[model samples]
Target: MDRITKLTSEKPVIIFSKSSCCMCHTIKTLFNGFGVNPNVHELDEIPGGREVEQALLRIGCNPSVPAVFIGGELVGGANEVMSLHLSRSLIPMLKKAGALWV
Candidate 1:
C-alpha cells in the first residue's frame, strides 16, 4: 500500500487537502464540530504533495483538495460531506469509524 493508503487505514478520519482551499477548511471545521481530530495532510505545504494528489486522482478519488476518507474509504469532497451532514449520515459514518465518541 502507498503512503496515502497506509495513513488512511491508520486514522479513523483523514483529509487530503490544501490549506488555502475554502472547501478544505470547511470540511476540517465540520469534523471539528463533531469533535473529530481528523488526520490532515496539507498538500500545498509538502514537497511532493502534488504527486500524492495525482496518485489519489489515479486511484479514482475526487481529483481535488479536501479528499475525505473514513475507514480507508474515499468519502468524496466538500459537497459530499455537506450532503452527508445534511442527511444525518455523516455522524453515523463517524461513529462507525470510531471517530466520534458522542
Candidate 2:
C-alpha cells in the first residue's frame, strides 16, 4: 500500500498493469490517445510484482491489473475509465490532474 502510494505520487497519471492483459493494453492505449503520458508499471515484469498486485487487491481492485491512479488517486479499471470517457468526464479529469493540457 505504501509502495503503491509512493509510485503514484511521482506522476500525474499512473497505471499498474500486467504485460499480457488485453484490458490493460486497451486502457494504456486510451490514455496515450488522450496525449497523457501516464507512468506505466508492468507488474508482471518487475520485481516484487506479486506483492504489488496483492496490495492493489487490498485497495479494491478486483482484477488487479490496469489499476489507474490520476493525481495520486485511484480512478479504477477499464470499465470505470470507459464509463468516465463516455460521460465526457475523463478529459476534464485528465486536464485537472495535469496529465493533459488540452
Candidate 3:
C-alpha cells in the first residue's frame, strides 16, 4: 500500500498495469490520445506485484490490470474510464487532477 500511495501521490495520473495486458495497452493509448502521459507501473515487471495486486483488492478492486488512479483516488478499470470519457466527464477529472493543462 505504501508504494501505491507513493505513486498515486507523486503522479497526477497513475496506471497500475501489466505489460502484456492488451487492456492495459488500450488504456495507455486512450490516455495518450487524450494527450495525457500517465505514469505507468508495470506490475509484472516489478518486484512486489503480487502484494500490490492484493492491496488493490483490499481496496475493493478486482485483481485487474490498468487500474487507473487520478489525484490519488481510484478511478476503476478500462470500462469505467471509457464510460467517463464517453460521458465527457473524463476531461474535467483529468483537469482537476492536474493531468491536463488544456
Ranking by TM-score: 2, 3, 1
Off by over 4 Å in 2: none
lDDT of 1 by residue, 1-102 (tens): 297888799899999999899989989998998899999999899888988899888776665778999988999888888999999999999999999878
* Better candidate by TM-score, 2 or 3: 2
lDDT of 3 by residue, 2-94 (tens): 988988899899999999999899999999999999999998998998888888888867756779999999999988999999999999999
Task: Give the lDDT ranking, best first.
Answer: 2, 3, 1
Instruction: TM-score for candidate 3, please give it.
Output: 0.94
TM-scores for every candidate against the unseen true structure: 0.93, 0.98, 0.94
lDDT of 2: 0.95
How many steric overlaps are in each model, in order?
Answer: 0, 0, 0
Error (Å) of candidate 1 at residue 85 is 0.6
Output the worst ten-in-a-row residue range by lDDT, candidate 3: 57-66
In terms of lDDT, the poorest run of 10 residues in model 1 is 56-65
Q: Candidate 2, which ten residues in sequence have the lowest lDDT sum?
A: 93-102
Best by lDDT: 2
